[model samples]
Target: MEQSKTNQFNVLAEKPVGSLLMQYAIPAIVAMAASSVYNIIDGIFIGQGVGAEAIMGLALTGPLMSLTAAFGAMVGVGAATLMSVKLGQKDYGTAQKILGNVVIMNLTLGIVLGLLLLVFINPILRFFGASDVTLPYARNFMSIILVGNVVTHMYLGLNALLRSTNRPQKAMCATIGTVVLNCILAPIFIFVLGWGIRGAATATIMAQMIMLTWQLRLFSNKDELIHLNRSIIKLDVKIVKESLLVGLPQFLINLCACLVAAMMTRSLTTYGGDMAVGAFGICNRFILFIVMVVIGLNQGMQPIAGYNFGARRYDRVLGVLNKALIFGSVITLTGFVIGVFFPTPFVSVFAKDSPQLIKMSAHALSCMVMMFPIVGIQIVSTAFFQSIGYAPKSIFLSLTRQLIFLVPAIFILPHLYADPLEGLWHAAPVADGLASVLAITLLVLQVKKFKKQMQAPVENMHTPL
Candidate 1:
């Protein structure tokens, strides 16, 4: 076990930046992409099997889902990041403690939030632009999802830990397994059992539970470097503070996303009605597919950057960042080309029978991706700051796209345009373009600081002393 642990550390420290990224990023990218694909598939099933209103209902649930993910990312992303840095510093004890705290925090938050959301589910959905027609489908889907929220939280928290603990492949496999399982069970539940939207939700939670079980078993192995210990399972004050502080940016991003989704849904509901909201939902799923790929790249970059930064390898940290930026740019640009030119085909996949839905979705998708070519830079830069323990910068950057720019654009844009829906569709690209500029500025400043840090030792070596 000791030798195995040493080798893992050595690889992170010694591996070439490009190869290391491929080793790490590919699994994560595969996992994220597969997860997104599953979402697209689930959307297809709901749209075809349930009804168009069901699709709108699913869209209405976006805000709630984002709220759930906000809490999960707070513990999961924060702890995983802290653990990665601890391992780089050779602080195995603290890293293990982080794992334990993650379990406790996820359980506590999941239960409390789940119960609260369940109680207020109807009102919340109504606030998020659910109409009389769409309310039942949204309520049915979210009820089942909220009930199994603890499972979802634990599964996500543990997977983040797996990546930080040198088990990226394992983390990847867990996500892929869940996605595959969901795909298999969704059709059965929705079609055979005739559960409709409720069936899709049931299939999702069941798949997550199965994978969560496997994750727990893996952590139970005492031979692992960061396995669970009953003695350390209790929360530590310092660890909890650090985890939350580190995870706050992600938490805020998701929280703000919840608000933004709600705002967008309400705006769409007002201007274009329920079908407009459904169109946004379809566009969102497709955009998520692309964004998830970028996220996968960031996940791949996280440990590498975090570990090297903790080790004071400024050059390696910067190396990974540059590579990630380049890769991220390419990915988002691809999404841009496809969305701009061939959106009809993709949108048609969801609702072939509904021409209005397809046309609205296609136009919205194109508008949303108008600034995609530079979107990757903003995403990568935010993750870079977070990986290096710059929580303030990370949090600010997270807010730039969602809260600072996007929120205001969503609000003011609609009133400016004669066609309110067109204004809403344009809000995203406007935010994207502004946020990318800010990200580039911050990234340049940070890079210069790292470069100076890198040159410091060389300058000292050349001195008389």
Candidate 2:
């Protein structure tokens, strides 16, 4: 039994850094893809079930949803990275302590946030550009989503912890189970049950609830090193500080996206109407899916980098980074090609016969994906900085893309062109280009610092890797 337990850790950990990275990435990719299915399913069914108007309503709320996710990713991922390093160093006690802190933190976040969101849902949706036609739909959807916040946060946040433990298969299982449950229940809620917009949100919540149960069961069953204990809920100020130090950068990153997205939505509604909002929704959803590909690589790299860093195998971090960059570039290029060449169908795959939505979405698609390659670089760099505990660098790199670049583009690009119609569209590509430039810049600086540090003459050799 002792040997079996040892073999288990070695399973994901023992492989060459290259193969192990891919092994880790594929499961993460699948889980993310499956998660995207929830969006796709909701969009397709909502577009057909109610109408394009309702689709726009649903779309209007995307930014807030994405905003909340930033917290989950921040806390969950930050804690996971910390835990993985501890686990690798054989400090299971510290690892479990961090794990406990993460669960408590995420749980507290969801409840406080859910209540706050419930109180402010209307004003928030309005700020996001909800129109008279779309307001009801957005309200219904956002209400259910806020009410279901616990499932969404706990399910996803815990999965990151699970991933850090090297249980990618279990991680994959929980994610897939959620998607499967959503698939079965969504259509029923949307049509058969006559729940409409609320139904889509309900189905998604149910799926997440199911996934959370399965994930909880895994920890309870055995063979797991880091399990959440009832006594672990006491807030350790040190652990909280550490988790915030680790997670805040990620939180700010997503928060920036939310801010930019809100600007986009409000502008789209003001200048274009429900149609533009719907189109941008599809554009944002597609981009989210594309980002997932990069995020998967980050997920794969997180554990490897953290583990090897803990083991004092700094060379392995470089190895993982190299592989991640190459793989991420390929995925980004493929997504860009698909977005540029086949954008019409990409929109139509999720949308129905609405010509206005199709046209607007196609336009949004071409411009939205303009920075696909930058997205890949940004994700990898964020993971690299996080893995090495350069939390400030990670946070800054993550923020500059959307906050510094995208926000400026949103305002400046609209005015740069004389035509008012140009106001709405120019932000997409301009922001993409600017964000990409920022991401690449940060990445280069990090690389330079890393090289200079490692290249310095040492007792052994002076080479980095």
Candidate 3:
């Protein structure tokens, strides 16, 4: 195990930056892309098998889902970030302890929150923009999902830890495994068994539970550097604080996403009605897939940047950052061109029979991605801060896009426009453009800071030491 750890460090710390990124990023990209496809497929199935309002129901659940992930990310991202740095510093024992704490945290938070959500499901959905037409579908779907929330949290948190511990391939496999299984089972449950929207949610949680079983077996192996152990299973206050501090950025990002989603959904409900919210769902899936690919790039960069930063290898950290930023830009740009030229085809995949749905979704898709390319820089810069343990900056960057820019745009843009929904559609690109500018400013300052640290005296470099 020690020898294995040493080899992992040598590769992460000394390998050619480009080659290492390719090795790490491809699996991660594939995994994130697959996860994105899982969502797109869900929209397709629900739109076709259930109805347009079912899609609206599914869309209304977006905020609640984001809230669920917010809690999971709080522990998962924090522990993974800490583990990356600890591994870079050669503190394997503490890293392992963090692994145990992550499990405890996920399990505890998942079950408690899941039960609470179940109790307050209806009121919550109503507040999240569920209407009379969509409330039943949302209620049925959310009930199943909340009941299995622990499985979802455990699987997702463990996957993040897997990547941090030099097991990106395993993490990739787990995600792809769920994607494939969900693809097969979703149709059967929805169409064959006639389970309606609940079938889609059921397929989702079941897939997560199965993949989680695989992850648990891998973590149970005592040969692994970070594995289940009785000694570290109990939570420590210090570890908990550190994990929450580091993870809070991602948690808040998702929390803010939930807030933004609720606002958008409510706005769509008020102005455009259920069908309009359904259109937003289709556009969101396409945009999310693009964003997920960028997240894949960020995941690829995280451990490399975190590890090298901890080892005082500032050049490698910067190298990884530069490459990730460029790659993220390319991904978003591709989405831009496609969104501009092929909006109809993209929206049609979700609602071929509904012309109004297609028209609204196509408009949303084009307007929402007008400044898409800049978004790559924003996302990568936020991840860069989180990777280097600059939690406050990361949190600020994350919130800037969702709360600082997007939320206000959603509200104000509508009143400024003759057609209120047009403003809502335009809000996304406005947020993207503003957030990208903020990212550039903050990242420029951070790069200068990195350079100074690079030039510092041997003992003065900011490192885990």
The top-ranked prediction according to lDDT is: 1
Q: Residue by residue across 1-465, what tens digits does model 3's lDDT show?
A: 578756766688989999899888888999999999999998899989998878888889999999999999899888898888988888888888898899999999999999999999999999988888899999999999999999999999999988988899999999999999999999999999999999999999999999999999999998777789789889888889988998999999999999889989999999998888898888889999999999998888988988998888999999999999999999999999999999998899787888988998898899989998788999999998998899989999998889889988998999999999899999999999999999999999989988998898978886532
**In candidate 2, what are the lDDT values of residues 275-335, reduced to their tens digit?**
8888888877777787786788788888898887666555676788888988887788788
Ranking by lDDT: 1, 3, 2
> Could you give candidate 1's per-residue lDDT for residues 1-465 as a string of tens digits?
587866767688899999999899999999999999999999999989988889989999999999999999999999999988888878888988999999999999999999999999999999999999999999999999999999999999999999988889999999999999999999999999999999999999999999999999999998887888798799899999999999999999999999999999998999999999999999999899999999999999999998888888888999999999999999999999999999999999888789999999999999999999999999999988898889999999989889889999999998999998999999999999999999999999989988888878643421000
Task: Judge candidate 1 against the unseen true structure and give its global Cα lDDT, from 0 to 1.
Answer: 0.93
The Cα local distance difference test for each model comes to 0.93, 0.79, 0.91
Please list the residue runs of candidate 2 whose C-alpha ends up more than 4 Å from where it truly belongs after superposition. 1-7, 10-14, 421-423, 451-465
**Candidates by TM-score, descending order:** 3, 1, 2
Considering summed lDDT, which 10 consecutive residues are worst modelled in model 2? 456-465
TM-scores of all candidate predictions against the true structure: 0.98, 0.93, 0.98
Stretches > 4 Å off in candidate 1: 1-3, 457-465
Weakest ten-residue segment in model 3 by summed lDDT: 1-10
| Highest TM-score model number | 3
